[model samples]
Target chain A: MNKFGIVMLYSILLFSNQIFGQFNALEKGVFSGSFESISQWYQDDNKIIVSVPQDKWATNNYLSLHYTFGKFYAGLQYEAYMPPLLGYSRKFDGSGVAHKFFSYRGDFMEITVGDFYEQFGSGLIFRAYENRQLGIDNALNGVNIRLKPSDFFSLKLVYGKQRKYFEESNGILRGLDGDLDIIKLFKIQKNIGLQIGASLLSHYELYTGADPLFPPTVNSYSGRLDFNSTRLTLSSEYVFKESDPLDLNYFWYKTGNALLLNAAYASNGLAMNLSLRRLENMDSRSERTATDTELMINFLPANTKQHKYSLANIYPYSAQVMGEIGGQYSVFYKIPTGSLLGGKYGTKLNFNYSVYYGLDTTFLGGTQGFESKYFAYGEELYYQDINFELDKKWSKAFKTVLGYMNQRYNKAQVDGGDYPIVNSDIVFFDFLVKFPKNRSIRTEIQHLSTKDDLKSWVAALIELNINPSWTIYAADMYNYGNAGEKVHYYNVGTSFVKNVHRIEISYSRQRESLMCVGGVCRQVPAFKGLTLNISSSF
Target chain B: MKKVRIILLVVSVLIALGNQSEAQTVLPNVMVESITGQEVSAMNFFNDGKPMIISFWATWCKPCILELDAISDEYDEWREETGVILLAVSIDDERSLASVKTLSAGRDWPFTIYLDKNQDLKRALNVVNVPHTFLLNGKGEIVWQHNSYVPGAEQELYEEILKLTENK
Candidate 1:
């Protein structure tokens, strides 16, 4: 046996006979789940969901087993699903368990080998991880080491391969990151603090395709700096990478060199954020391969507000890691108690606006036939948005929020292909009423207007909260414009919960898109049906 | 068309009602082939009654390559002590699978090799990228999983394997 192997074997035996001694009765069991019929009726064909079995099954049904003793943790899972009934996929017909190995020895560090998720410096240059409900898992199949030398400083280093669906890619990925909280480290500068970080990642993969100009290796580097004080805060970060023509392209063209810059500031209840991104053609994947949204060495956090309601999140913005220019500004204020606008309970007002437009082409200068790293190839802004919200409390039992929004989207960029520009105006109002004891009711009304697509829409929602254990929710979204486009979507749901366990049941006729968090994403076709969910952790 | 719709709906409703066995809903099985001419199947790995470690990787993935290189030195010991079976599967696609043999021989990897030529195994695992690993117990059921890699993570895996296989 190899030296490393020998060492590992001894370590296992020593810990086995020493730590656990015996398996706990709670650790043994056969866990399973099944979902034979799932229908997503909003698409053109009924077999849509069947084609992507893993996505459908992971979203619908699966089973996992977990057990732990002392410092050791282990888990296993089996996934099996039938063909999708509606807009789901049929090809996802396999199951495999994901494993995790974690070790925590005092304050030195905690390590996880095999498959693990990590984010460094806001995940600008590299972030590999998962968000199940979003169906996204970009876990690295390798090793991860974290060190916390002191309460004020932390360090992390990771190396491995990116996971593509169920398999690992052939390319290599390695990164090193360090974070130092200056204030805590110094002790005296508690209120006034600073933080700094840097990361370097290299991916080595040989060119396999017909592209002649591509290189066999690529490198990416990122750095961040931040300062925080009781009354003021500022943060700045930058990312850069070596150019590879074959892997970075968006409209069937070679990508160019790239770079990005971001800065933000805040004080009291007021904060402001600004960012300037200039990407020539920066797309990094494990196999140097590109899908709609995979293999990104950097993450673009939407500076714009993240919408919660379905309509607001409908045309959610995706950071253009290729090439784009944009900025954001926001202001917030809280009225003092006992004022007219505050209405004896105080009021809050917030305003935000953001715009994204095409960059000028003059910045990139290339050869006669060769592409430049910077160019404004397309016309029209990818997206633009603005919003304002006001919250007021009339009494201990009553509180409300009113908001307005305006947005513009270029059909060609996000949704793919050119159509027409999208212009929309929206208004919304929500109220929360508390009754005697632990009872509360929340209601929301929203209206949206646009000239293209659906034309106009109206939505209403009502929710009841019985503190400590139960919640009932109901809502409907109605499209009032466009002859046959007028569709009524409604949902009524209830939840029963206690501590770590929760059970939810709902019936609905809904029109919506599926969303994945982290780096995993899949379209969730619309459906009209009943659903049940139960989750518990021990 | 009307008849087809009715049939589909009826079938869906019936299936939903009869699927109480807790066996109908599962992520699809993703198959991968190894350079050694072994057909690595995910179905056989599920809930197999032994602690299993399946590492999804490729020859070109730099981090993955490094991770394997780092673990190879200790893998044998881990197996001897915990009886953990580590399956290293490659998703090199059809065009690149030809080079798998050369690469594995050059690196001298000791674990069992499997090839996922068509990437059928990757999609079933809900993997959007590479270098994902899954851990399973004696029943072939997945217990825990992690994505991405950092240095010194293999030691952590051994820790879990020991805890899992000790009393068995």
Candidate 2:
């Protein structure tokens, strides 16, 4: 329940493990857990446009403990925030037992109580999860039970109130899902595996608005089918929601719909995947009045390349809940080691392309916001990326990765339009050299030449490891395209690691930008500060 | 009342474990999805009672990929001596699920892999970072675990597997 209690419990666990080893002959269970604590000190710097709100110091900590014995398992998570970080929400400025659950999984059935997270079919219709960096925890706080009567049939039932901030949402949510293995169900000895599933989710809350057509409850249903073989896999899901007036949709009583499809083919040295999604008024939330990353009950993943490079991710994308159509296609190929293009080691070439367009819709004003035609695209382009990369190992001691990208980001459409559309060309290089005695050095260099927005920029990072124990990292990003003085953002840090404990301290100047994780974006203002991070596990 | 229930659950579990002490370190029976989008249980992945080396990783973590590559270089030699299998667990969220599938194919990883999209297994195993590896004996009990990566960490892992078979 508290830090002291947790430490005491762990001590008791360690003490009991010793006693049990001597007395209990048949059973020897294990207790394992980890904790991470971050502390930061902020200092104001008008030169870099960093403004620190009244508070200058912030710290956050989380400790989770899990115990497993035979078929029974229990876990507890404790979190403390002595005033959360700047970008993190203030609502988390407290200490408490964030999650606690007990579950028993048997051959025929599994049951859980307290807090739990789950998802169904690409999470297009329902997803309950926790993203600590984003300050979101929608874990169900009730009961969940799954029944596997046979190898072919599986069913699940869940009821709970969604977690919001430090508390639970007012509305109550309930869902039931059933999955059937068609091939196994019929005992059909076929090559391809077939599975189908259906889910019905509902949310209930008291009506507080005077609108006569406003419904106090919302219902959504989803169905999915999946087929897979040794080299091919296909999965599709469709969802529909009843008419409900909520803030996200201007309190208009409009129905919602969504469709997602993914198909892939893979061989020994080649693989390709394609994804398609269409969402129209499909923003589902627990509370009718919730808006903008609040009380979300479903997850609509943005079908775009999640770039690994810093500059490539500058213009990230989030799926529009109102109306959007998009898809992504990616291919990965490995040239054999002895081929003409492949030198001594095999060469890896990756190509990725993605595009999203706004829905072609006309507004009717008043309660009727707009109307759109299916399978029609507007002239507006939300985001696009054409990227290719090649990875090669020149020798046993050297390896390198080269990449190029062309991107078009519609600021008005993707980032709520504070600036003009930005088109950029990027080049990336990564080299790693390994020396004897487990020593290694890695360097990453990226250059983005943009004609708009922040203009052209260049970044370089180097990481040197003195083998098994110590590492030093440094990086700097400079914006040269900006007229007049060049703006530079730099950071240097060192980390020491031994066994399960790791500690890192760094001082850096951050650039103001929108950082995104899984299509969800958060604004991180420019700041000059010292950060300390520590992690330990047992 | 909530805190009390939590304490009660923990105490009850401790008592149960104390009373039902059993041999054979067992992997927790958690459900995870494979690359083909099929739901599978971790319990059935014991490799017919062979040694198992499980690694948790993410696409964005560069060190993790490096470590896996090093292990892949000698995977065949290790398999010859001990009937061991490698199980790679990708904790990539929905954003990078495509890459996980695509990379698995192009690289032709010679191991069984699963996706822990929501980190259920990662949390169950208390892995704090990517590149964390676990070595399990023939009995499926997790005998050794190490976090992070060094160039020759796999050698240490192999030694543990050798110790397991020797004890047998």
Candidate 3:
């Protein structure tokens, strides 16, 4: 066995008791936790042909508990995947305590031992976190310390190994961060604010390869400045990394860097924001061989809107970490209640546009990656989005929303597939009507038009809510524009909720699509199944 | 085979539900960000002198939007009657965080909003779902809590808020 495997075994052996040992008895210290279980039983059909499970029943369950006594806190997590569900990585076949941490906080200093999650400024250079839906947890298993002597400045230092699929990666990571509030240091009590921060992170993996061009250690640093007033705010961060090659980048030994700028202005009835980002071979990972979303050291924030509707989510955008430049601008305006545009109640409108293009570069044959010019926009179009929506309340019991979206996506260029370019248009109409004591109904109809890829699709949904207890929803999606075959994906679900607990059961025929939550995308395979989800905390 | 899977799932769920006696809610001392992106402690706002109503919501959650909108219509009245403040905690990560402010402001929600971009506060508070509401007493003890949102759920929250202040 490898050294990292041995260390992982020891960690599990030492903390198995905390995870398995649960008591109903009362104690001095407060204990709290939450449990979530999502399970599916598949019934395969000729349509939506995909991999059938070796295990007919697949379940993913996570249980977390925490104990707190005064100023000290300790927590542990246990995740069980009786073999993983479809689309989830095979590395998650086993179950164990995935995370554990112990922490202490004093007046001026704090210390944490064992496993923990940390993020530097805007997470441009280093961020270790966990996202359950996306099946990502890169928490560092090591020691972290923080100090603040006199409130003028605060400092943080972290050293550990990134968690790679329930085991430690074969890399050692160390980082330091410091933040200073210029306004606070000067004791300015005005509404304006100013802060500056810097972070430095480095990771070294023992790569005893024969190639001399490969570097064992890669270092990166970032600096940021943020300023804000009551009306306007501006923030900018830049990251620079030393030469490092990885399996994803095809082992190209070139320097990597990223720059991000954000600005926002808010008034009484209007809000506007802008974000710009440029990435140049900035894929940083703890494990050299890690691909897909594993062992990521930094997350490139996708500069685009997160669409919630089904038709809108068909072409969600993920940032191209290798090289790309993109920007997003959005404006939200609230029309006056008595104005002409707004009937009795005020109207809300939002307009957003974002686009990305490849960086102009020429690949230099071998160990060296490529060469690029600054501020050069290439002719290669990666993605484009133009969407707008208007929401209005007609009466105390009636509301309506309308949305229109135009999207252009290059599947071969961006997502690394050999499909042709896809240009799509989507429209959404939503309505909500209220009835007598504690009853409401929501309805949505959406349509998408496209000639390439999945062709065209349409969906309709209706949800009924009875206050304080139950909700029932039914939805259907039909691929009418597909020339080969036509399929109707349908789902019927009901949810029962009580004080701090919820249970849901659904029968769904899901089509293949990318589920994007918070700009992160995960591809869920097509399946026809019965699913159950339950969550509770106490 | 299907029957066996169903039986196993039902058994496990029942075993989990059998231990639901105590329901004490305390804010874990995790740090989150305000709407302006400033770091603040979770325990500070929910434990103020007045009765506090802490609601967990997200930008993309439709049920969360319905719940918050339902409450906003009567928020002024609720606050006037019971000196309670509604603290909306959004569990939007970097992906959808940019929309929280615009959505909330466009809807004219009159509540102090904070961002749980990393979900630190949500994990610590054991909130696995959005639209979860927690009512706290003046002393910062959790008085009542509810999960999910139906149209008339705000009535229960109002009644619980009244009960909390009345008990005090």
Best by DockQ: 3
Which sections of candidate 3 miss by over 4 Å? A1-28, B1-22, B46-48
DockQ of each: 0.02, 0.34, 0.42
The list of candidate 1 runs beyond 4 A from truth reads A1-59, A62-92, A149-154, A180-190, A209-213, A245-272, A275-278, A362-379, A512-522, B1-168
Candidates in order, TM-scores: namely 0.64, 0.92, 0.92
Cand. 3: chain B TM-score: 0.86
Candidates arranged by DockQ, highest first? 3, 2, 1
Could you give me the TM-score of model 1 versus the true structure?
0.64
lDDT of 3 at A506: 97
For candidate 2, report its TM-score.
Answer: 0.92
TM-score between candidate 3 and the true structure: 0.92
Residues A119-227 of candidate 3: C-alpha lDDT, one tens digit per residue: 8887879888887888888999999888777666888899999887768999989999998888889999888878899999999999988987678989999999988
Error of 3 at B47 (Å): 7.3
Query: For residues B34-60, could you state the per-residue lDDT of candidate 3 as single tens digits?
Result: 776566777677435779988999877
Interface DockQ of candidate 1: 0.02
